[model samples]
Target: MLPDLAAMSSTSFQITATTGAFPLEAGTIFTNTVEVNTTLLGDDPSNNVAETAATVFPLLYIHEIQGSGDSNTMPGAIVNIEAIVVGDFQDNDGDLFDTDLDGFYVQEELADYDNDKSTSEGLFVYAPGATDVAVGDLVCLTGEVGEYSDQTQLTLQGDLKICGHATLPAPVSLTLPVRDISDFERYEGMLVSFPQALVISEYYNYDRYNEVVLAEPFVDERPFQPSAYLDPTTEADAIDDAASLIARSRITLDDARSAQNPPLLRHPNGAPYALDNRFRGGDMVQDATGVLGQGFGIYRLQPTVAATYIEENPRPDASPAVGGSVQVGAFNVLNYFLTLDDGSDICGPNLDMECRGADTPQEFDRQRAKILAALEEIEADVFGLVELENTTGVTPTADLVAGLNDTLGAGTYAHIETGTIGGDAIKVGLIYKASTVTPLGDFVVLDDPAFLDPNNTGVPKNRAALVQTFQDNRSGETFTVVVNHLKSKGSDCGGAPDDDPVQGNCNLTRAMAADYLVDWLSTNPTGTGTGNNLIIGDLNAYDK
Candidate 1:
């Protein structure tokens, strides 16, 4: 029978070490030792307590202590121990055995026994009710030391131990905003920051009643510099004022990096202003406060100081009397075609008498009769007709001019033909009285490159503008007349999905032609430099 085992109480323990005995008094931490053991040494009867008593002691170490009450009610001490083997024990298979057997055993001598191995010296005790513990934490345990065959162990009785607090790590810093154009001044020639928002408060009377209110952010700004001036103002004064402001504000870098240039400010109302192109119309100069408000705004300015004095020079006067009163009429005569078989038939071979069929003799007579009557009533000095066709190709347009002049009796009319490549079958024609307004020469044809192909072709193959210089009968003053026919409704040649460009083709073409005419008129001054230039034709473009 086994000796009566002693009952252990819950208490704390102190730990000390000796070569032959367990050094822990009451409470100390317990850790796993003799890591290679396959079974609990104290429970194996084959290697009983008597066998362990004769074995040499193993090394033991205290790691923690445990207790439930005062020191007097201490449970036991927990210590980790390792055994020393004289020779290896053998199994039936002849494999060498190196672990604990069973029963009470003496502790082995302490030595550095492979501390790197986690199962050996590295083993730790986890506290009771605690989730986890780190490598270096000092733990305490309460238990009794016992031994099996070749190993020493601890018998745990009560609660285990733990430390309260945990180790933690340090906290982290955050960056700031930068300055841009909004923080600087905005003005032409001045270093001022560009206007973040250019607001157009009012756009007064543009194109008579059409007004446009507008605003935009200042995308560009520069320093102002001048070269020369024109008649009215000196370039030096303008440059001085501009340079002073520019020096105070930031100077804009030149586009080519060649020189210092002033910024250009475009007004919402179609006016452009810059230090170089400064005139008085739509740009503002700031007061001492650097605020640009209303009043005589600069329209255009030149960079060279010498360019500032350039003025609109006046022209010399000339002769007044002689030419007859000229009346110009623009008519879209629908369709006027001469017959191929008989010259007398106006509507040609297939039309009906009522001007409804493809071409007929009676229809020709009816149209001609009406045209003659209208001509007699208006007594037009010049006529512009559209949609005139001929059988011989060139004959019809000439015939109409001849027929009208003959019918009128006194007026001598001539048809100005536009030399279009394959458009002789039907074309836009001009007829004018030679006696009232002498033709300054021949007709000038305007060419349009936009409608060079069929997909862009429709009512008008391509746009053409006719320019004729005529001597006005009443003033003897020569006047320039321009007749234009622009593009018509059709599919867009631009290959756009909606065909929006072709839908507005006529208007766009007409506007372009008008712009060309304006440019020409500005350059060409006629008849004492005061004669009127009239643009009369079936423009086919709405004014809007």
Candidate 2:
């Protein structure tokens, strides 16, 4: 209500009212009218009433919307803000579908920053069709705040207005090995730079997602496999702690593209990551700068500028020399099954188990070629193999030996024939170079009840051991080789011996198998009475 005006002179005044919880959706206008009462006389009655219109919404800063927590405060609220574009991932390529995220990132200008460490001043505006904006452009837009895949974002509801251009904000500097894994949440969707040299720790997703994990090198050395250093049974807590440290120290370096198996891969040095120019796990990337983003439960750095890549860890051309009269080696031939994994259940000994490994003829050819090259390079006299298909017909071991002989003359290599040693879908195998070593008496197999499941059934849980004695041609020295495949930690056992946080699942079962092996070998199971023994193959347990 307006105050009464004196006689013929009129004065303007102000009114403050709250538009509590405007219920309409975004872009809707709310109007208000003011009228003069009968007590207040007006010269013209027609001019007594006046109305004003406004798009009912709050105008908030980026920090206010992001809040000081992991999520947004006004998630479903419609609001307006003006900020400068930081990183633009809009689909500029004329593809039918977006190759990257069809949106852009905007951050508050340095002058307008709220100066709050806990709240982020940058935000991702999910405008898939936006076209008129670029980096450093000051733009005002009305949008509804929302959470997409645990990330706070904005969806445009009204026309975005481009104000004048502004200077780009400086990116915040950060270091690896943060105190906690959640420490990255504060800088989510913001521009950040790492001033120190970081090493590539893992590239498991590089082939598929154009991404590689970067982390602070472990004590200035390459990251070692946890299982190689710590015992999963005794040092379980330490192993878990080391894993947490890795999680806190690492961040994914993405190509800023969303396409899988990109035709042209990108490297930090502005070069294509090709077969010749590849990056290993220990390569270093210096002074990396990018926009930090969270998606699919991973924190990634979408590079904004090219960085220097140092090839500190080059690919090894040949295997290291061990220097001995006879060389013995072990390899895990991961699911080397001739039976195709083509949605059929006609593999294994019973002919009813599902097959694994290559799914097509083309894939099988590629797999065989790589395996053959690796085996030839090892140059070992005797090799213990794991994960071979447990089928009755032409075995994987026979196929591998044939491929080897084709490369290195005929009668060069031979494989032991113990038909389908166990009931499991996969079994262990042994192969040797016939020219270097000769087989002794019949190969022995430890197929005791200890390998069976805890229910005392005939079904074996661990694959039976493949034991053989070999005599070196030059030295005439005999050594018994025992190959084994123990129960893995991937699944659980029933009851009190299920799984240990320290050693993982099936710890007791594997321990029991180890005990049985020691007892069986003590009884001279091979009957060669050779005290010289060598135990090998996938024990499925980590070394201390």
Candidate 3:
């Protein structure tokens, strides 16, 4: 017995005993059992000996063909490989049948058969629109190893055989807070279970793709520090931590159901998990057993079993009205518009594509329902509304008022009309319960330097604030309420001098607007001759 050749390349090797001292006939084949060592010197010497016939074709494992290289492409030709089907898209035993990531991922049955952590034991089968196989089926396949996008997957060649059903491998236990980008490759296509519950942080793509981003905890983060510390290092560190948490601690949960906006959503208990109308950002989830999949630059947890959902944030009831004779309120109505979302220029000065509200009448109806609910719940006598669609009509503000009053009664709520103020598609308006308060005069809107421009933000740096005097019908008490939505820090007046090193975008404009607000409020802009005022609105330029 000798030593192992660094390692054996094939399953079988042969040796001949045609010694140098003796010559054999041309037709003679060596019959001597020339022993070969298949182990290292450190290994047992007696157990190292081997005798076998060399073969033309050799069996290859999935990892051997996959190799350990990080590059997408495999260098050598791969004849064939075998693995059990951990994923073949047959997991849908019931109505749920979603496989949006496409392609099945096959992995070796036993855990770490070759004991090489550097190489992956699993490989994705990139045969799209082909789904004849079932999960847990053992398979032997011949394929051309090419990378589809960045994923190293096998494009099936010749005829593949599903040997039979077998016990699927146990799922790998993986936890969250994946700090590095490359940490997910090992678990790709492998059955994995999250160790702890993940909260649903984003559901904007819920209806579109049945996709939800889940984090270990809530991620509805606020931008700026509440205290005015203004420390650069602290701010940078906080921002970095926040950014990392957003990217690192999330897994995209893809629904197994092929349907969109399924009528019945349930918890793991098989009861309704109804967190608000849809699963909002704070809903907790657990018992998510899924195949880790990647496509289009997103890693999706394709659930083998439906994930258990806990309604962390339930549907909120209407807010209790504050006990006051003059009930003044401020509401941000996230851009309410009446023009049937035809994408025509709602605001004359803005581009037609600037339409940001509901894209359809049905959508508008849905949005109107929510706004109506919110306002009616507030039950405020005086309401200063912000972010209404800027358009000129006989009653541009009437649509919302009509929608509100329809819910609260025909004569319940009415809003002040300013026609069209600025060119931008969003503006502020005033609304009040007619039974509770009366409008003394017309709603006043300003486009001056203080209200609109600061650091010369090219016209309206701030939304045109509307000032209107409301008289308490019973007590004859009159006060002013101005609704102002200032320039937001995001993409605000983004020119050279306007950008602040510490305060960031549009801070100067907001400061100037504040100064102008104080001076203008001193004079009583609406001029009921009343100094008693309630000036409340969002100063958006202060945050990241």
Candidate 4:
């Protein structure tokens, strides 16, 4: 009679000992006992299994035949059966499972089969030596426990077979674009480098030449002083190198004495020297000999080197009264050139040196010619000229006035020099004919008095504002004209966005000047009949 298997529950058993080799055949069952732990079956026993492994306490049945040659096993028989571990088994065979085809294995399948089974859980069964058994191959797995190694190892109950080798999904791809740099060609002359950003502080057209110019006044950090150089061999060099030279040297007094004596006099008649003719006003003297001797005491020495000078003289042939209207002309003479065209050999081939090699005679001649031409073009009763230099240390103001009065041969002209600030040689001035407008005297407005320090100061004299007042001779009207050249925006003007109230100190100064002028005008009105008051010059600010 068949052993009664009806009372047996479907259960898992661990092979206590294997009597034969692996790939156990059907009907070849050895004596195997059902484990006391019920968790030895199913995919992930750590998590509660929906169905526990069948219990086979009294006896177990050969319910199904698995593995090679296991099909003939009879059901309900107490067969010492070799079981086939059939289900989803992944091994060396590439047929049963594929990642590209079946997708990834579920996480539950890879978890421990039971809390007590360490090595058996999440372990896949595989047929060794199968083509799909290569390293890096992945496959699905399913099996039964044939033997046990303490609490860790698991042995196959039947033939370990391959389900399939997994195939990896295809890799992903990407793309990116390139950039261009063509527009930077125009900035070639600026001495700029690549991948850099340069911020311009200020840009404007200079009124004289009407040439577009850029200024970065913020760079002016300190006063400009001429660098002193001395030759090592000369006796005068000893004085320059003396230990107490800066303090004990009497260059000013020595300079005065040198001016009194001339080694070679310009006048052949042996006449007494006129100060104006004997020495060019702004010339500086350098003596090689340290001796304070007799001949040097009696006669002045000619200047070894003259100061850098530029001059602008008014047109001698100007006739503004004929037109009955003032025409003002602004020109940048482009260094020291009297004429717009090339004439003298001084400049040679270079365009920058228009009046080169010009002696006093040539300078006078060239200046007269240019002034005549400019006056004819401007035809203004009043004119403003900037960037003028001259020999008298008086600048171009007096010379221009004198020249115009002499050449026009009609009306007398007078001018007042508006001195410089910040050690700049360039000064602005006004030239007008006495026949059209009478000079009413002029005064200078100084920069804030609070900036003056007794210990340290800039450029000797403080920054000042020059204001000149005049009267219209023809109309008998009084006009107060305030001429100004305000501080430029490039320096210490704070930064953007300009709307911020805290920044723009230079703008504040300009505003202060404007307000000061307004207040002055309010206090000192022109004449009774709505006096013709005009405020002019480079205000250095944009009109609101």
For each candidate, give its TM-score against the true structure.
0.33, 0.75, 0.66, 0.31
Rank order (by TM-score, best first): 2, 3, 1, 4
Candidate 4 per-residue C-alpha lDDT over 280-347 given as tens digits, one digit per residue, 9 for 90 to 100: 22122222111111121121111111222111222357443655344344444323323223464332
Candidate 3 colliding pairs? none
How should the candidates be ordered by lDDT, best one leading?
A: 2, 3, 1, 4
C-alpha lDDT of all candidate models, in order: 0.37, 0.79, 0.67, 0.33
User: Cα deviation of 537 in candidate 2 (Å)?
Assistant: 3.3
- For lDDT, the strongest prediction is 2
TM-score of model 3 (CA atoms): 0.66
> Given candidate 3, what's the lDDT at residue 197?
81
* lDDT of candidate 3 at residue 184, scale 0 to 100: 75
For model 1, the superposed segments whose C-alpha errors exceed 4 Å read: 1-324, 339-358, 390-393, 410-412, 417-425, 448-461, 490-506, 520-531
Expressed as tens digits, the lDDT of each residue in 1-544 for candidate 3 is 4445567554543344332322333333222222333443354546656544222122356676566665333533444556788765533333334343445678886853577665667777755455467788887766667765456777765456776777888888878888575677766667888868878777766655667777777444312332243344467665555556556777888764445565555333233435543465687888777777766687777776666777787657755665767777788877777656665654433444356677788888898888888777778888777888776552446877888877778989888878777767777888788998888877777677657876764566687788888888999988888788888877747665566544667877887887888788898777683887777767674433
RMSD of 3: 11.8
Model 4 scores a C-alpha lDDT of 0.33
lDDT of 2 at 61: 76
**On residues 268-328, what C-alpha lDDT tens digit does candidate 2 reach at each position?**
7657777777788788998788888888898888887777889998888876776878999
